[model samples]
Target: MYRSEFYVFDQDKPVPVIIRNYTQDDFDELIQIQSECFPPPFSSELWWNKEQLSNHVMRFPEGAICIEVDGILAGSLTGLCVDFDPNHMEHTWEEITDHGYIKNHNPSGDTLYIVDISVRPRFRKFGLGKLIMQAMYHVVIQKKLVRLLGGGRMPGYHKVADTLTPQQYLNKVIKGDLKDPVITFLLRCGRVQIGIVENYLEDEESCNYAALMEWKNPFNRT
Candidate 1:
């Protein structure tokens, strides 16, 4: 087990727990977590379908992972180590756009994409998500990838709140709920946002925020 201060539980409270990667054998458990997290999450049957798995995110054999407490699925993430290829990413965006599925995007100097990071509702604020992200960051760095990327949304990407104004929009809206906690946490960890894609999700009206963050390893840059 990778023991660290991050994994240490608060003595005063019951810590939401369990973290590990997924195997082919974990298909069922993995599917269960997805269903709980997404609005219209992918079904286990859908995930297990051979055709879907081929095109699915986190294509690595061990890239798909889960966090569970006891026996129930808490959260899961699908990630991959890939070269920075604009053409390939654009191609993927084009194909998925045809089906109304927006691509989650972020770009770094051209190394790794921290594809997905999610924590279960009950598990939030407990530190598992950070643990997973920290782990992924190290793994990507070890591979000598230039940077890390991922996709996220602006506040109104789904539904705009009528109460908030433009100023409120930028501050409370954008900086508050509009901001992705994962991205915010990432930024706090020294990653710099390098790019943005406007109107990236909806029909040029509602905007989707695409951010790129880079963590340069001094040794690798040498």
Candidate 2:
């Protein structure tokens, strides 16, 4: 039921943009977007299925949201609540997200854990991803969560893995010497690099590694 509308420019033309909670009706477009965003070696089988998407909207409606640009499904962000401990942050994506089913979503948990965020290639230039993330930040505040956290893919790591360690690569990215597609995007969204997690995902580019990042909610009194 959460909805927000605005306009973005497309070559001097004002295009409509909408950010809202997901519903069963958006399943088809959501799946299509997943396929387009994570194609081929990214593993088609890992793409969001109807059942998992169903669990998302049903279990945590506010955390499962999508964005539309000029009426086209342009992006989405899905998350869940968890009782996070900064001292014990090691966990794989499958373990954290319940293999994308999110059956372990804890409504009383203090942290908003992002499961995934995808933006269509054509819509990336419009900063749609950031807007989607902003919506999730709103959700964290509305739900009174302490922070937002996620494991970011280092898709650009493979090209330099032979010469750099994962931590070294991440350090360089933080120091502005390197730019990773996912990590850099998250950095721009006000997320801080927490650490590197090995065996976090099945991505070849990242050598099965993921960069942990988080954004603390300033308004949370707890």
Candidate 3:
């Protein structure tokens, strides 16, 4: 259980938040938060089952982290190490996260596959997402991993799903011609859209397609 304290602005006033590793005790809270943060189809069917949940802590103990602000379980993130050639493969969340058990996770792998992150609804506007992302970066450097990769639900897509292709919409958002709360924020955090992943997730807002992204570690530069 790694622990640290940081602050993020809440309505322009800084509020203190805690960052640390996930614990079995927090599992129920995680499940509750997932239900609140995501919809039924995805949240219910796709969450880590009992065995997978246990394996998360046992396998990649160092990478699963949680966020707390004033003793509230405000957010959390869990990752797994994956060995893959960036040039030749693309994987769905299940394939890379190893169906949540992370059964194939290689502790010495080159990439950190971020499988899940959830922020409580009330805490969403306080910049917690970026804070958690920085924590993930810290994990990459701490583990000496090469880079991080994942797919994110494009919340902005539902508004334009009928009018534009996923790629076109993402390009516009990337170019600043369009604004996407989720995708835009990640872009600011130094991740870029690698491509569109079909059936990447079952979220309603993104229409089941996620924006594939990657962030290289600054520490990896040599």
lDDT of 2 at 61: 92
Worst 10 residues of 1 by lDDT: 98-107
Backbone clash pairs for candidate 1 read: 105-151
TM-score of structure candidate 2: 0.96
CA lDDT for candidate 3 = 0.82
The numbered model that scores best in TM-score is 2
Q: What's the lDDT of the predicted structure labeled candidate 2?
A: 0.92
TM-score of each: 0.63, 0.96, 0.89
Error of 1 at 152 (Å): 2.5
- Candidate 3: where are CA atoms >4 Å away? 12-14, 39-43
Q: Judged by TM-score relative to the true structure, which candidate is superior, 1 or 3?
A: 3
lDDT, model 2, position 9? 84
Ranking by TM-score, best first? 2, 3, 1
Off by over 4 Å in 1: 1-18, 40-59, 70-72, 85-110, 156-182, 199-206
| lDDT by residue (tens digit), candidate 2, 1-222 | 689999988879999999999899999999999999988767788789999999999999989999999889998999999998889988999999999999999989999999999999989889999999988888888888899999999999999999999999999999999998889999999999888889998788899999999998989877
